[model samples]
Target: MHHSGERGERPAIREKSRGIWRTVTWRELAEEAAALAAAASARGLQRGAHVALLGDNRPRLYAAMCAAQWLGAIVVPLYQDATADEIASSIESAKVTHVFAENQEQVDKLLEILPRCPTVRCIVYDKDRGMRHYKQPELVSYASLLQQGRQLAAEKRDFLQAEAARGTGQDSAFVFFTSGTTGPAKGVVLTHASLIDRARVAAATESLKDTDVAMAYLPPGWIGQNLFSYVQPMVVGYCVCCPESSETMLADMREMGPTYFLATPRVLEALLTQVTMRMEDTGGFNQRLYRAGMAAAHRIDAGKTVSLSDRITAAACSLLIYGPLRDVLGMSNVRVAFTAGDAAAPALVTFFRALGINLKQLYGSTETGFFVAMQRDGQVKPDTVGPVADGVELKFTEQREILVRSPGMFKEYHRDPETTAQARNADGWFHTGDAGYLGDDGHLRIIDRIKYVGALNDGTAHSPKLLENKLKFIPYIKEAVAFGDGRDMVCALIDIDMAAVGRWADKRSISYTGHADLASQDEVYELIAEGIAKVNADLAQEPALAKSQIHRFVILHGELSPDDGVLTRTGKLRRGVIAERYRALVDAMYGGAKEVRIDVEAGHADIKVRDAEIIGHRQIRSAA
Candidate 1:
């Protein structure tokens, strides 16, 4: 509303539909939000009410959030793809009475869970598809809601304005659910001041302006996405463009050419995998050129330029190769791209910077309102998440767990002050739970979770999560789990990428029935072995991690998924669950057995352990 008063006619939100961009100016956005607020208020919505929004990055969804917040309601954004059971906990915890669902799919999920969540009084749906048959009294279309809102506004214009004005800086704005590796998601509460203050600080630090634009492609449930798309844009008055759907996200990003972009490590790795596969499919000449250009780019990224000829060749390669590659990946116009959520491979980070993209790392979580540390331009390092963010107080615990006290830190863990107390200290420093150190260069370098990372029996440092992340950078490997916490050597359980390895197999005429069949294939194992070899080579270059290189690995029969309880809703591996489920396979990998029993049905595919090829094919006998 503030922006609307200042720049009412400027584009605030843009949504792609039917291959065309549909924009909503600041004035229109404010009007729609106000209307929704008036309508909800007319239906008994009040300040401090909890509102659940289930959808992707839709313009209407953002408007819905604004409307809810305007009435002093705490917005709880659920992952659009979450199942009924997955969201039932959050819905019950927040006592969400009003749900703004994106479409029939989301509405259906809500309907399935409504019996368990009887507090839901209204379900406002945006799309009308497949909704004609529904007879639920709680269901209402968004258009109808707006119509009611318009009527109320005509009679009582000041009502909505007064409601919006009642909101205070300390009022709770959002309740973000963090899906940790092993828990029911925790609802993190953030106040309006905490969220807006950090957004402004980051906006100023980055020199962002109203002219800048960004794509909201990832799941809005993530706090990082909420900050980058919803919170920051409101603070900076920048336009946020949403893609039509997940399938068209890349094409939309390429078309919109968003000035600012944020991607998770998984997203970045997927883009690189696409580039890798495309190059592998091209002619020999193009493939050779890509390799040479990337080699030169790597040299350039490392600041190892030697001669004038090197500079000339690299510049020509950028024009001929990297430039087109950037365009295809929809990052050509991206000014400052960021990667977060999880640790990214150093090589992967360097890969983009080599191509002249200002790719940097961000370190934070849902608890920090998603801004704790960030890499600044020209101060970027592959291994660090730059320095602590501006206006943030940071320190280290005795165990080296990163502790931060930032303006953006969450107010509390909703309804769980005991857990909150365990995380945040009396002095306001929130324990990040991540073990890391601040180097002399003032950059924060993360190793892994304090409890999950330790030393091997030989006293060599072991960080399985870090090792797993690096191995996953290989296009052929989708997920890897490292073991040998107190053992002499590290071993890994692997999950192959169905699309990537399938395409590779098709090109080579390798026969396979399914993911399980592919894993059982000798050739597929060899391919994965080759990928691990490359990871080992890269590890050899890093003195601190070389001793912890993967000694043996077995490709599982299938991918880890949330449905199977092996992965969380946000796709984080449930290590304890996986270890327990595949105890036999783990034993076989360490016992030097040639094979382990497993189940592979049409849907349920468990770990299919085969003899893990040793690093040098020397065959690992049971390590006693």
Candidate 2:
């Protein structure tokens, strides 16, 4: 709000609505937030009351967040894609007194869960096209809410300002829900001081400027997006662009030309897959030129050291191919890009860095307000999340579980004192639940979840996440689950990326109906085998991990989904659930069966039967 008075017309948030770009200037944003704060006060929302915001990337959601904070209320961002059951649990747990829904779809979800959350007194909705017929007492149009605020503001001009003045740094800022891969999601409580302090530190570390632009497309519920799109943007006074929809994010990014970019490993993989598929389609002179240029560029190390001849070739390639390719991927103007939340494949990381993009990695969680370790300029390492952030201290347990003591560390788990106590020690160190160690260079290399790190009977260690990331680097592979704990050799169940593989199949003139039919093809099996072989070749370089090579594998009948109880909403595998659900398939691979019949249900009623074809040797030399 202070920045708005000094810089009245600067754009703070931009978004596409009905195919046209619309911007919210800083002054206008402040007015909207203040008005909304007045509305909350009129609706009897008190200090410390939780306000749940559910929506896709939109300006109103961000404004609602600021408005809640202005009234000294804690904001809880719920995933727009969350199921009704998930919504109900979050609302009940947080005891949300107010909600901001973006559209009728979101309002419907709120309606479904309202019976379980009786504390919800006000439900304000934007984009009310289909909501005119609704007769719910608690439902209020977003425009109406603003009007109510206007009336309240007229009655007492300083109402919002007074509320804001009453808030303190120690007050709760927001509540973030963990991905809950192992169990039910936990609400992590963070304070205003922790978030603002860390946001400033991150901005300084990156040398962020008000001129820098960012794209907001990830789930608002995730801490990664919350930090990048919400906290940092506010602290640095940068513009955050919201895409029209999930399907148009890349196009929007390209048009907006964001200077700072952050994507999850899955998003990066998808983008890389698109580039690879496009390159494959280019033929003759262009294809040869691209291949030659990329080969020359690959020779240049990530640090940008290059021979004279290599530099010349690289510059020529950037002009002819690399520059346009980066533009198409929405990374041409990206000054500092990062991939985080999960292990990114080394191949994917190096692929962009080799092309002169400053793609780096960071490691943090909701508990740390999202700033723990970050890669600084000119110190990129694909194998590790770089050095600890300024003002953060990092250590490890005797078992190698990462522990952190930082100013940005969250206060507690909301209403879950027992879990909160378990997350930290008496000395105030927060247990990260991640297995990792500091490298000789001071970079932190994460192996896997502490409890998920396993070993073979012969004592060779295995990190399923590491291996799975390697597999995902292959454009055709989407997700992988490695199993070998206490067993003789590692094995895997793989899900092929249908979009990329489908394009490949079309290029080859192969006729296939759907994912299941295409996956069962022998040719698709060969493609998966090729990916596994590449992973094994990489593993051969490390003696300790060589034994962890996948000796046997099976192609899954379908993609693992959150609704299926196979994957969490954030894409982390529910390994125990997956292993038990597919026990028959797992047994067949270990029992020396060539192929096993499997039954998968599509949605609630459609029964689909397919065969899990095992295709590897026990000795691990070659596929059988």
lDDT of 2 by residue, 1-624 (tens): 876986669999999987899999999999888888888788888899999999987999999999999988999999898988898999999999999999999999889888888999889999989998999999999999988887777765677668878989999999998889777899999999999999999899999998999999998989888888888978888899999998887788889999999988888888888888888888877777777777677666554566787778778878877888888887889999998878787778888876668899988888987889998887887888899999999888899999999999899999989988999878889998899999999998888998889888999887788888888888898888888888887888888899988888998999998988888888888888887887887676566677777777887767888878787777778888999998887888787777776665653212122233223344345532
lDDT of 1 by residue, 1-624 (tens): 889999999999999989999999999999899889889887777788899999888988899899999989999999887888888989999999999999999999999999999889999999999999999999999999998987787665777768767879999999999876755679999999999998998898789999999999888888888889999989999999999988898899888888898988878877888888987888687777777777777776666755776677678878877898889888899998899888887888988887778899988888887778889987888989989888998898888999999998899999998999999989898988899999999999998888788888989888887888888888888889999788888889998889999999998999988888888888888888888877776666666776777877788887888788888666777888899988878888888777777654554444444433333322122221
Q: For candidate 2, which ten residues in a row score worst on lDDT?
A: 604-613
Residue 351's lDDT within candidate 1 is 83
Report the Cα lDDT for residue 126, model 2: 92
Candidate 1: RMSD to truth: 3.1
Cα error, candidate 1, residue 494 (Å): 1.2
Any runs in candidate 1 off by more than 4 Å, and if so which? 541-543, 602-624
Q: Tell me which residue pairs clash in candidate 2.
A: none
lDDT of 1 at 310: 67
TM-score of 1: 0.96
